[model samples]
Target: MADIEDEDEFDDLLELLMTNWRNVRQRKMPTSSGADNTAMVASTASTRKNGGAKDDRQLAEDAKVEFDMSSGDSENLPDEDEMEKKVPIPGGVDIDLNEQAAPTIRLNPKAKKVGAPRKSKTVTQAGDKSDRKWYQQAEQGRQQAGEVTLRALADALAREMPSLVDTQCRLSGVIVKFSSAESKKPKLRMLKNPVVTMDPFYLLPPKLLDACMKVLSVANTSECAIEVDGSQETRTVAKKDQVETVVIKDVGNYSRKQIENFVRIQNLKTVVQLGLELHKWLTIEGIPALPAKYHDVANQVAAQVLETYPYTQIDCLPALPDFTFSMLYRAIPPTWLSDASIRALCVRLTHDFPSCRFAGFQDAVPHKTRTRRSSAAPVSREIQDRVFQQVAEEGVECVLLPLNFHNTHWCCLVVVVSTQRIFYYDPLNQAVHLKAANAIAQHLKISGLQAYDVAAQNNPIQFDAFSCGIYVCWMFIRHVVRGPPLDMSANALPRRRFELFFYLLSGRLLTREEAEQHEAEAAEEDEKMPAPPAASNADEEEDVPLTQVAK
Candidate 1:
């Protein structure tokens, strides 16, 4: 209450103290604290307010002397704390008076004096100076912003291309499209926007893949196309006067195939070409060839086609083995070895592709601790565990189960992952292994596999009793190759067997080069061979070799 009149005085006192503090800071003077601070500020203000100009001169001289002593010639400043606290504040960045962020300004002990002339008086406010120097004021801000943008760009680029940093895989990359014939490397081709990339065998046209798959897709699923003809090169099956050409129908029914333009086609070569494309597509999509997933419907269509069209042998060469419809290579029927053959085929497929798993035909033997009431043979927990783990790890696309029901006959069950369907294939009899198939399905369901419905396949029929095993093995191969169609008669099996033998001997899938090589050979053969005897207007004019499909 007594200091009510002093309210204005107190406010003035605070203002003067603040002003005094600012002036001391500019000259780097030691700041006095507590009661002494208040007293010194009050006295200075009173002296200036009363003594006017003369007292201000004294204060100014004192500030000049202080600055000269601290920062002029001597390396050491007596008031070290004063130098640490009183840093040169950056000009004109907005600072909150209520919550000022105090900066820690370190004064180097052996500090070299900054190359700036000292001003006699302090200019506190931004507006006091006519020259604001906008560039200087925003220097720190600009640098900070630049760093942030650069960081962001670096992060984005890394995500898009981690290889950008590698010298081998520099971001400034080039692509070279060269032929197998080309010996010398061409000049580097700069990658343009929307980069065009292709496989190593890019020489083969992409359009051919669809055409080839279309023919193969049907041929593989159908067993009728799996045929052999050693003298197929010499034989002419059909003379179509309507098309004015001789069309060899090949071993199986290629009734629907349009082979009206080529020199010749070897059926095995076509199968090889088809197999090659299947592998390429599967590899591209990361789908397994044998016992795979996702590419089911397309595979099915291709497989079904195999049943309808026999693999036509058009481009048969003299050097290649005679693998036609002969008794020497006739399809052998399965006997006691049927079970072993089927199991062996599954094993072979599994070994070929890591994605495939073969569940064998052999039943688990009962354990010594088995109860009399338990009529079913006991399964080895260790074996079951291992199988489950393997299937899980391999992506569970397809499982081939070759069953010998009641030690009587052979049957195949293909478990497709994506479709969740078990293809129950028994060309001789579908009812042969119903109980066994059911039991297998139940076991799979119980053993943590996805539930699968048994779907009947129009299996290829066998002539001899032993052919069931052969059929089962062939089916296993088909599964690995995304399936070939079922053959109607057991006659085609011999041809199919011969093809399989060639594949095994070669130990590699046929490529575009192989097909192209055969084409060259066919062309040579056509050039050497004489023109066919021309018939009447109703008869054919020229030969139309199987050129309907390509890979």
Candidate 2:
């Protein structure tokens, strides 16, 4: 009994091992869904039990048969159609893999392959299979349309014949109308104002424009049709006598911009009248209303300027609107001061200060004259004569020589004629203009004048590109008036420009006392006003009822 039990135990152990191996192999095999793998497992277990006395070769054969059954298609395996139905596609659409897919695009049914030319299928008559030639039909159509085929040509040509003739007639009429209209139209009036013709103040100066035209190689005169309203140009000068010379004092009531507009609108009869109005507006009102920072513009020199303006002489004034002080006063983006401005200012300065001779920009040196020239003769005798003529003739104390560097920068040389010393004042804080200095020294030598020392004066340094002109003007003022130096820092440049413009326009200068008094009054007024409540920012006034608001 013990021996029989051992044999049965060994058989059961062998069957269990075979069952586990079959399961592992079945999991790895690529079998179809619904395949009965259990059949192979059961068959292998039965063969092992039945063939307990079988040889090793027979056992190996049974294992091989089990593997083949699992590898090959099973009787319970699902059909292709059923498997296709069970499979899931990405977009939830059934795809047929059996049938060939139709092409997305098809070639045109009548298109011919690119090779030898073939006859066209177009028929000349209905239901006729004869090929029609395009060139032959086109030639026939053309010949029949002409006098060759009288009957067919008459029928086809009759319809479009009038349209062609009518079109030609209409085009002729349009051409005639255009020519007549051009002839009838009045000729465009050219610039006829005498002030424009004379080119006063160098506004649209014909000589300069013509020179530019010559440089540009433009030969036509009609290209330069600078339209100047004849009425406005003539009326301003014509009505000069009729306009009143009243000084507008009520300008203080308006804002600075409004006052500027008022000044622009005023059709003053003379420059003196304009000067008086500017004096009232800028000196008495405008500068006083500015912020405290700009108060420095009102200094002793400005006061002196106020006392000496609107001179008895009439030739001191500039004629063109562009060169006028009204235009120069605008310094939003400061521009280099024009030679005309410097010349006019010099003229006025000479008239005011008889002892100090002022040289015009042109008289000092020719336009764009470089000091780096190899020739020792810096300037021509004519220029030297013009420059030193006043100094020699009047025995002037000093000569104010304003120099324009490359038409971009401006600096001034204060030549003390008596002492023979030249003080250079450049806003850029650069080294003394050596070449200009050498030229001046040479001019003095040729003219038999005393040799002067060119020394650089300690002037305020300009931090910007366009403020050189303002600095030059300020230096000229300081040398002439002998006043304490005013602010010329980068921060103060704008106000300084305003001051210069006001000085030029009003013929008035600011005084320190006036500036201080106005500032004190403004401060006192500020002190008298009530400050806003601390809670004002947190809650708006409208949110809190007016009745509940703090007084």
Root-mean-square deviation of every model: 31.0, 34.5
Model 1: per-residue lDDT, tens digit, 204-293? 222322333334324343536656678656666784333111111221111122221110212222433344443344344322323232
Stretches > 4 Å off in candidate 1: 1-340, 364-383, 430-432, 483-488, 501-551
User: Tens-digit lDDT track for model 2 on 1-551?
Assistant: 33546887888767656655654654434223223444444554556556645644444345546555442434444445665576332332333322234545423323457887644545425324322343344345444334322233333333443232222221121111112122221211122331111101101122322222233322235757656785755544554322112111221111222222222212211333334444445565556655775566554424533443222222346564345443342333434566655665665566667777776552233323434555546555665676667667655777777766667677777767777776766677654454454456546654665566656676677788777776777777777765467877766665666655655555555544455677899999999999987655645555645577688
Error at 44, model 2, angstroms: 96
lDDT score, candidate 1: 0.43
Candidate 2 lands at a TM-score of 0.37
Candidate 1: residue 60 Cα off by (Å): 99
Q: What is the C-alpha lDDT of each candidate?
A: 0.43, 0.49
- Which portions of model 2 miss their true places by more than 4 Å? 1-322, 329-332, 362-373, 431-434, 442-447, 511-551
